[model samples]
Target: MRELTHVDENGVKMVEVGHKGEVFRKAIAKGRIHLRPETIELIRAGKTKKGNVIAAAQIAGILAVKKTPELIPLCHPILLTGVDLTFEFGEDYIEATCEVRAVYKTGVEMEALTGVSVALLTIWDMVKAVEKDESGQYPVTRIENIHVVEKVKAQVQ
Candidate 1:
């Protein structure tokens, strides 16, 4: 069995292995990604022609978070306590951050990541129509910095 690290009586490092699983617990996770320039411009200009870019993306993110289990196999279905999604526009790219909280036996990190990815894809779908010019050129190029920010386990007395 693999050994796991834990703090000892004097706050010293200790190795333990084969710990038993606990029932009914909760966990948290986070993620983010960068957006391309043409994608940003399409969002800013409201030229999607389908609808408001940000609004649609936000809605898609929320929906994705809720339906994460359905989309991804091996992920447990969880009742999310809360989900917050935000977009930060930068000079060269856009930052998408998704935070999800749930009171289940497993963490919601995958859900949060899925939400961000869907949001970005939604943006791409909406803008791809307008991004293609006469020469089939597009400005948006990449997405980066997708990761978790923090995670915590609640203790019961």
Candidate 2:
């Protein structure tokens, strides 16, 4: 197995990227949130009490990508070139895909993953009223399959 990057003789430390050459990097991440069929319909119809669910989630995902360094320790504050969040609806789930692009020394995989997570959570926030059971707890609502779908770094093409 490869060794961890954030470690040195002094123990644990943030990886220094100053010596690394800058490169164009792009990362795509995805996740899904399962909800009641009713909730899905409400979101698709733009009838959720919280307003447009997809719009809100998209905004949340973009903001999360910008704030990733603050949330995850050791992450460099990269200047992102672009951030896009897309959503797909299934019969009972909403799938979020976050694509982040940057020209920096390090990859943006974590930032993309963070964006997906925030977007899915935002959807949960918008639909909780309809997903909660009589016991005031969710019986079937869940967020799953969070993962990095792709990560690429190379010279400008």
Candidate 3:
């Protein structure tokens, strides 16, 4: 059986990648935020009183990427070379992808994941006013399908 990387016979511990060769590592993660049609229209017209949802979510994604090490236990503090976030809107959902690139021994999958999750959350927050009904309950708003879409490692050029 494959043993857990974050644990040993002695219990939980951070994975050591210090001795590994440095390389260009990139990761892409994606997630979706679901909302009512009315909320989507508010975002499309940039009418949300809270402010520009896309812009705020983009900034939140960037910040989340840079702070991944601090947010997730056992994540290596790698200097990321690039972080990009894009949002695509559907009839009732918004898709967010965060791509993180770094030249380090460890991959940035966690960072990319963190970025996408935070971005989706920011969208949820910005549209909360409309997502609720008179009953003050969220019937449609949800964040889901957060996963790593890709991971690549190569020698730094």
Best candidate according to lDDT: 2
- What lDDT score is found at residue 79 in candidate 2? 100
Better of 1 and 2 by lDDT: 2
Which of the two, 1 or 3, has more lDDT?
A: 3
Instruction: Compute the lDDT of residue 101 as modeled in candidate 2.
Output: 99
**lDDT of model 2 at position 78:** 98
Runs in model 3 deviating more than 4 A are: none
- What does candidate 2's lDDT look like per residue over 1-157, in tens digits? 9988898778988888899999999999999999999899999988988899999999999999999999998899999999999999999999999999999999999999999999999989888989999988999899999999889989976
How many pairs of residues collide in model 2?
A: 0
Q: Where does candidate 3 clash, by residue pair?
A: none
Which segments of candidate 2 are over 4 A away from where they belong?
Answer: none
lDDT of each: 0.67, 0.94, 0.94
Model 3: weakest 10-residue lDDT segment is 124-133
Expressed as tens digits, the lDDT of each residue in 1-157 for candidate 3 is 9878998999889999979999999999999999998888889999999999999999999999999889988888999899999999999999999999989999999999999999999999898988998999998989999999999999988
